[model samples]
Target: MRANKGLAGLIAGDTAISKVDVSTSSLWYRGYDINELCEKTSFLEVAFLLLCEKLPNLKEFQEFEAFERAHRDIPDSLYELFKTMPSYSHPMDLLNQSVSILGSFDEKNTLGSNSKEENLRKAMRLLAKMPTVVANSYRLSQGLTPVKPNKSLSYSENFLSMITGTETKDPLSVKTFDTSMILYAEHGYNASTFSARVTAATLSDLYSAVSTAIGSLKGPLHGGANEQVMYMLKEIESVERAKDYTLKKINRKEKIMGFGHRLYRTGDSRTAVMKKLGKALATKLNIHIWHDISDIMEATMIEEKNIYPNLDFPAASAYYLLGIPIELYTPIFAASRITGWAAHIIEQHNDNRLIRPSCDYIGPNARTVEPISKR
Candidate 1:
């Protein structure tokens, strides 16, 4: 029997982490609607919900918050490692290497410790330290000094602060970033999450699973779509060119970076929330060009092909308005997705499986091996 290509529509396994209802174009995390979670909670709260299997109560939230803040500092040795690397390296590559290095630092806790309690501890550490690694690695690469994480700020604020090398005081900016994180936090068994789960199913360490996920996310079809979207917008330059540019790409049968998704047909459920937030940021920053260009491009694509913009489409402009570097987009994704990846990793560890899938052997059928001398 022929299997689905890229395992499309294949129910490989079950998950309680998050659900993407493609029919309705809605997403829920642990039974909470993504829109409600964005409006009612913070990214860290969502992280707690994903990992702990429920939303945290007040005391639980406070304790979790404190733990995350406390562990934001990575080793000075990591900084030194970042400094030694060539500046031309991609941030995602640095991030992947950083997680592996971090695994080395916590081998005692990570190795042979797939217990829920231990995995949760490791997960929290990764969630806390990822921002530091992502921001500092990029900073060091740019020949700029790394900014230390400010525990006093909220998770999103501190993340922006570190990336920008200053404390973020704008509430709207912080909220937009937080919402983006929440939206990107989890989606059921996407490529990266599935890869992470596959690694975890082998009983490997949590960091190894996360490293695997990060590498998978570096592709343009995955988390790198956000970065590519930004580049495309920049290439289009202005609103006047947007329609023609989109039509040309469509006519040429080129895959637009952020126009469609494998999961959502009518639309990506996360897009509307992000588009609103992104437009608001555009208005706030007095920079209407990116969104204006995007609006035209979006309309053209829909009218021509019935294709809808995904979350990454608006997110690119949002992050641009927020003053984030384009290349850091996927790494920021990795930083937020560490929560979901860990949750999946922990779940896989709890129900241990080898995750070895069989494939149809379509190579030369019944071919016998012959010695070189005989040939």
Candidate 2:
């Protein structure tokens, strides 16, 4: 029997959290269309919706925001731990390690139960602290001082502030970043989220599941694509070089880092929203060259191969224009995706069978072991 490669088109399980409708080229979180959510709701509201299974009203939203702000500070020892690591370490690895370390700190709560209440608390804690970890780990790795989260600012503003080591109050920048978070907050069983569910199905603690997800996301084909996309942009570096660079890569049949996604044939639905915001950001920053180059490459890929850009394509330029470091891109993805991953983990724990699947016996069938030196 042939096995499904990478579990393509496999319906592994059911979810009420989100849906990816390829028929419509659309996504919905808790039944709300993503584009509408991005336009009207904050990232915190989306997080609440994903975790609680419904959008929060005003009083509930206020309470949820307060809880998140209250838990933003990780243990100081985590910073000390960050200081001891080599600067050359990848931010994702550091983030993965830091999350496991956080599990140790929360042993009392995490070890006791897989109850939804307990997991929800843990999820909210992870959601709150992940931005701190993503920002400070990168900063500390660069020999800079860690910045504390400013509760006065909104979630997106605070995250940007911590990463850049300055207050991020610009309206456009904050909105763009918040929109990216909402877009990335969830997708139905992408690699990382699936791995997280698999781990959770084993009754693993929330942190371990999240760490497993992070490890999966670190690969180039997944979350790391954003980082690679930025690097590719930098390599092209000029509008004049963009089309030639893209066509050369295409002629060689190289996999363009952010051009295609398996789930969407026409294009990633999230990409258009991000591209518009990214172009606006580029215009606002007086940095048209990146998006200009992107336009040439995007048109070339679609015209030549009928391929379209994914969310990572525009996100790379957006983050670059925002003055974010190339390396932090995937870690930032982790920060946003914690919401989705935790929701999956919670869902899995609530209704789980050990996620062990049978495999096709492709190796030497019915092989016999010979005694040592008997041949």
Candidate 3:
């Protein structure tokens, strides 16, 4: 059998969660289109749809929101633990540690005996608390007081408020942030989601599985791409210089972050919605330089290499314009993606199997071990 490096096109297993359709460059959660969700629903509602397989009704949404709000305040010990961690540690690492620590706090943290209800409870707790963990970690690292969640704000607004330590009374910014979250809520078997599933297939508890996913998403090639994209845009510095910089990179055969996606040959469908939001923010905030530079780079890349920007491309500038710190990008991704990761874990547990795949051996035939002393 022919081997596929990175298992590029291999269908390892079935999932009824999300689909990434290459031909259309579309993403869907359950049966709903990503664009529709982004435009029509709040992130809390989208999270409900992802985790529960249907959009929440008024009563159900109220219940979900209440549960989420009630769990928003993480243990004070977690914040103290953050102080002991090195300030220079990547925020993703801190977030992963938080998840592991959260598992320890749960008396029912175990494998196998987790009923659907139990798993849902765990998912809700993580979903509610992850944004707080992310926001507080950043605040502590900056030598600032950690901001508590404001239940008065919506889920997306509360998260932004926690990070900024200001109430996001602005409707537009909150809406844009919520849109980003909905767009990011899920994709079919991305690296991090796959990692979560692999861990779950081993009969691990929900927290362990999610922690595994967070570690995987921390890699630059995955969730970190948006941060890299922002760095790249800043490096370009000017709209006039963007073309030269991008073309030089292309000539050098260097990989450009956020320019292309594996699943979308035409383009990322999420790009349009994000790009629109980015443009609106740039215009309103009068921080048009980043967006203009992005436009130039995007044009140059497509003209030179026919590559289109993924969702991460536009998302970087939008987040920057929103006054977010660059280091917090991937953590934001994690906060949004937690819903998707939880959904996959639940699905994996529903019909569990060990996700073990064999690799072809290309080393010396029948090699024998030698004694250390002989060597």
Best lDDT goes to which candidate? 1
lDDT per residue, candidate 3, 123-162, as tens digits?
A: 9999999999999988897788989888887898899998
For model 3, what is the error of residue 55's alpha carbon versus the real structure, in angstroms, after optimal superposition? 0.7
Each prediction's Cα lDDT score? 0.92, 0.92, 0.89
lDDT of 1 by residue, 1-375 (tens): 555889888888889999999888999998999999999999999999999999999999999999999999999999998888888999999999999988888856646788999889999999999999999999998888999999898888899999999789798999999999999999999999999999998888898899999999999999999999999999999888999999999999999998898889899999998999988988887999999999898899899999999989999999999999999999999999999999999889888888988887667868778999998
lDDT for predicted candidate 1 compared with the true structure: 0.92
Off by over 4 Å in 3: 367-371
The CA lDDT at 94 in model 1 is: 96
lDDT of 2 by residue, 1-375 (tens): 444798887888899999999988899998899999999999999999999999999999999999999999999998998888899999999999989988888866545488899899989998999999999988988899999999998899999999989898999999899999999899999999999999998898899999999999999899999999999999998899999999999999999998888788888889888989988898887889988988999999999999999899999999998889899999999999999998999899988899988875567768688998996
lDDT of model 3, residue 323:
85
| Model 3 TM-score on a 0 to 1 scale | 0.97
- In terms of lDDT, model 2 sits at 0.92
Summed backbone clashes in each candidate are: 0, 0, 0
Ranking by lDDT: 1, 2, 3
Mark the 10 consecutive residues where model 2 has the least summed lDDT. Answer: 104-113
Reference-based TM-score of each model: 0.97, 0.97, 0.97
